[model samples]
Target: MNYMDMYKRWLNFDEDTKNELLNLDEKEIKERFYKELEFGTGGLRGIIGAGTNRMNVYTVRKVTQGLANYIKNKGIENASVAIAYDSRKFSDRFAKEAALVLNANGIKTYMYKELRPTPMLSFAVRYLKTTAGIVITASHNPKEYNGYKVYWSDGGQITEEHAEGILKEISKVDYDDILTMDFEKAVDLGLFNYIDDEVETAYINLVKGLTVNKDIVEKAKNDLKIIYTPLHGTGNKPVRRVLEEIGYKNVYIVKEQENPDPNFSTVKYPNPEEHEVFKRAIEMAKELEADLIIGTDPDCDRVGVVVKNKEGEYIVLTGNQTGALLTHYILENLKTTGRMPKNPVVIKTIVTTEMARRIAKSYEVEVIDVLTGFKYIGEKIKEFEEKQSKDFVFGFEESYGYLSGTFVRDKDGVIASMLICEMAAFYKLKGMTLYEGLISLYEKYGYFKEDLKSITLEGIEGSQRIKEIMDMLRNNPPKEIAEIKVREVKDYLKGINDLPKSNVIQLVLDDDSIITARPSGTEPKIKFYFAARGKSYKDTEERLEKIKMEFLRLTI
Candidate 1:
């Protein structure tokens, strides 16, 4: 059916959805009905409403039924899927709906008893040996957005191969063909079941085991004062449990933002990458004189840190800073203690800071760069497990996602929180703060600064405009950026370095600076990533500013 056909068809859906559609103006109607909510590589994500282009029961069911078909075709008898949800609007409803649809298609589902983090879903998939997994969340997007992410049995987000195959099946599914059954019936038929604490316990235990400086955690227990905020999402219980159990008693929660609130009432955007989201936490950090503050996003997959600088002002650290800090802590401790795994390797995305590569090389640990998603990192981990060529120690993306252990392939904000707290404690015992620890890393690994700028272009015309912008850059590769000569330009879409083909470009500058342009995998935006280094912070930042100014001038 075309847009009108789908619109008319959806008009007769549930009364609540129909009412939502009836209230929309002409433009809103077109925007919501312009096309089917795209089931891209990640899965469904969009504004919630009643339209072909919106997230609703009909669309969710259609996608679930398609997943059911793909799983059934895998020839695995009695294959099941693990399901989890975050604290998002309709997250529970979409999760239950997906479960029942899968049940109706003869595939069993093991769903979390309550809302959980995305990494928990990834862990559940592998722990339960399910055929696939699904998590209903939009990560750190604004409250109006919700999403569904699919994971293969590998405990990682689906890669391009699985995405392409599953999307083909999703496209073939029709509304009439999308099967769903009663929740009670599904449960009675042994198709719907709640996940037990077995998986949860195992997950928390794994996160706790990733702690490197165990003795330091105990020593700093009395000294380090930490404040945490869940940002009205799902990181509350596990993050606190990990910290408390690992030997920290001074952990404080930002009560105002502690609960699971879909509205994310306090923050305009629920993303931890943004400094604004740390406003409340910063206030609490100042009041309590906290050693550091940590905030995780809605799904609890990404974490941001705020620390008191030498000037005594709380500032949020960039994802790159946090990532590099964690990398150094992990490797330095391992090397000093002689516990470093043989042939240990660290992985980072192409757009991540070059400092990670440099730090890993300093430790004699191999560093490999993949395309821009953690799924690719997870893929490398899987490859290592099979080939036994190298041991995967850590992987991270510049967008505040990090993973240490192989228990969960996706980023675990809970683990990150625990490890970050441990790192802080380790530094405090050495009589330094996390910010000071960050500076120390800079000194050892050279001064580095990174920034990201995103241009959001929503709606139909905005989508077209994004394509034009990418086309402009691709067709006419800039010879220079921000007055610096472009030493080399790498276009990944043409398939570079044997990595998966993606619509991304990276410009390496003559002065050892780096810039990358890539559309967000989960949002309708184009992002530019800049990384710079110099003898001092001011020099690097000045060069960074010039590059940013010129890049924007060329692209925008």
Candidate 2:
């Protein structure tokens, strides 16, 4: 059926919903119903709107109902689910609505009484031994967006096979048949439980275990001046409490963004990737002469940092740079203390810089590349646990997400915040800055800079345009980008590199630079990733600028 037919079906809805659909334009309707909410490697994320395809009450109900059916089919007599939400506009309501649907289907449910981080939801699923979990957040997406992510019993997002099963069940549900029992009734019948302080204590204890160098934190406790901002989301309480428990004496929270505000009043785009989001925090840091500034996205999964360079200017570190620095710090510290794991492994996304791989190799640690999403990294962690062949050391992605101790199944900003502060304090003891530490790593591992460019294609035609761009690149792979000879191509969708095929096509240049292109599975955009290396920092910057200009010229 056409989008108009779908829109017409909504005429039976109450006047409020029916009138809302009738007021939408053709483009709006098409955008809303262009495709189903797909279970990507990262789970479901989309702009909230009125359609079966968009994130709405009906979509949420279908997803929850599907999850309930999937859990029941697994032969678990009393299947349970945990649900949490962030501070987005409709996140809390959506989460409760999902819980209601699950309760109606005879599934036990545990939901947070208030907003919480994505990682906390992952931890809750395991702590409660629930059959599954749901987090109502879009991570760092704009205010207009929201999402629903599903996690399995192990606390990691559902694997591809399980996701397919859930999708099948979702398809079988008729929108009108999704029933919701009263919240009071569900609770009275013992089908619902609100997570409380006891669960919070368990989570905090797990986070505390992530601190490897407590002695260093003890030494720098009174001296290290650190600034942190939760960006008006769920990280505020946990992050602050963890830092305090670790003995950090002078931690400054950004006052304007300290509270949970759904609007994210302090910035235009709440994403930490943009330097502008840190303008106020940097100003505060400068005045206090703080060692570092940290900000986490709404759901507190991805983290961003700003540090003083050698020239005394505050600079925001790219996700790759931050990950590389953190990786180097953790591995070297473990080795120095003679505590390095014998069978250590470092996990990263396929698009992340190979420089981290090189650093890990130098430390005699294995580097494993997985598909995009931290869930793939979590899957690898599970693989290691079952096989006992390798120990999971660290995991990260290019999009400002990292995991260090595996206490949580997802990327954790709270732990990342604690580790980043410790790293800064470690550098301070050497009379250096985090910026200087990063530079030293570049000098040791060969200078490298990475860049990511995301081109948004909105509405129905936008997706087709993104596909056209990807197809164009695959058919006519760049022979040379900025006069550098193309040495190899890696197609991830085909699951081949020089060895296998993948949807991603990476072009290796004669000068050892690399450019890769792939369509984002969770959003309507194509991302281009570029990495260039040089003998020194100055040389690296020069080459990076040249390659960036060439890439822009070609793509834009």
Candidate 3:
């Protein structure tokens, strides 16, 4: 049936809900019921609205019921699930509704009483040995959006086979047939458990283990001036607590964004990648003359940093730059102190800069590239644990997500926050700013600048358009983006570089520039990842701009 038919069916409900659906405009209804919510590599994310397809209490219940059914079918009789939510609107309610749905299915449920980071949810799944986990977050989406990410016992997002099983279960359920029981009754029956301080303590202890130089932190504790913002999400308490516990003094929280506000009142977009989101924090940093400014996304899974340059202007560091600096800092510190792991391995996404790989190679640390999401990195970590061949040193993506320790399976902003503060502190003790440190890194390992351009495709046709673009690129691969020759191509979907077929095409230029074009699995957009390197910052900047302009011309 069409959206109109679905709208009519929805109107048959009780007065309030019927009115709510009726009040929505035609465009709203079309967008909501255009199609079923897809389970991408990142899980379900949609605009929160009233429909069988949107993210509402009913949809959340239906998805949870399907998950519960899938878990039961796997012969997990005494299965348990951990649940957590961020500061997004309806996140808490959606989490509780999901827990209750699982509870009604005779599964044990452990949910956080309040908002928490996405990584902590992953950690709780492994630490508590739960059968599965659910996190209510949309990552860095707008305020009107929300999401549900399902994770397996290994703490990574559900794999393809498991997700297919859950999808089948979801298909079997009728929207009106989703069963939900009373939350109070679920508690009384011993099926629902609200996690408390003990879990927090365990998580905090795990974070404390991520610290490398306690003595360095001790020496620079009082000298560091750091400003942090949670972006009105879930990082406030845990980030501050960890910093204080690590012996950092004068760490200032962005007062306006300290509390949890579902609307994220302080910023237009809650994403840390966007410089506008850090306007308030940056202002505060300038006033306080702080050494650095750090901000985390809604679920506290990604982090962004800003440090003062030599001209006294704060410059926002890209994810690639941040990862390189942090990785270099950690490994160099470890090596200097004679603590560097013998079999260290660093992980990054396929689209991340090759500069990171070169830097790791210089340190004799192996760099492994995975698909976009952090789960692939987590899977690699699991593989390393099983094979006992390599030690996981660090994992990062070009989108500002990084993980220092294996305590969390996903990208962790809290850990990133702690480490960033420590890095700033370490640099301050050496009488340098974070920006200077980054410059020095570039001078040592050739200057590298990466630019990412995303073309948003919305509604039903948007997905098809993105796929069509990918198909076009695959069919008629670009020989040269500008005047430079395309040397080789690496396709990730085909799981090979030049040896096999893949959806991704990386064009290598004569000047050593690389251009990668791929459709974003999580969002309805096609992203162009550009990486250019040179001997100096000026040379790198000029080449980067030239490459960017050439890419735009070719794509257009």
Model 1 residue runs over 4 Å out of place are: none
Q: What is the lDDT of residue 10 in candidate 1?
A: 79
Comparison by lDDT, 2 against 3, better one? 3
lDDT of 3 at 86: 94
Per-residue lDDT over 381-471 for candidate 1, one digit per residue giving the tens place of the 0 to 100 score: 9999999999998999999999999989988899999889889888888888899998888888788899999999988888898888888
Q: Name the regions of candidate 3 deviating beyond 4 angstroms.
A: 25-27, 497-503
User: Could you tell me every candidate's TM-score relative to the true structure?
Assistant: 0.98, 0.97, 0.97
Residues 79-192 of candidate 3 have per-residue lDDT tens digits of 999999999999999999999899888999999989999999999999999999999999998898999999999998887778889999988988777777898899999999
Ten contiguous residues with the weakest lDDT in model 2: 494-503
The alpha-carbon root-mean-square deviation between model 1 and the true structure, to one decimal in Å, is: 1.1
- Candidate 2: global Cα-lDDT? 0.86
| Location of the lowest summed lDDT over 10 successive residues in candidate 1 | 1-10
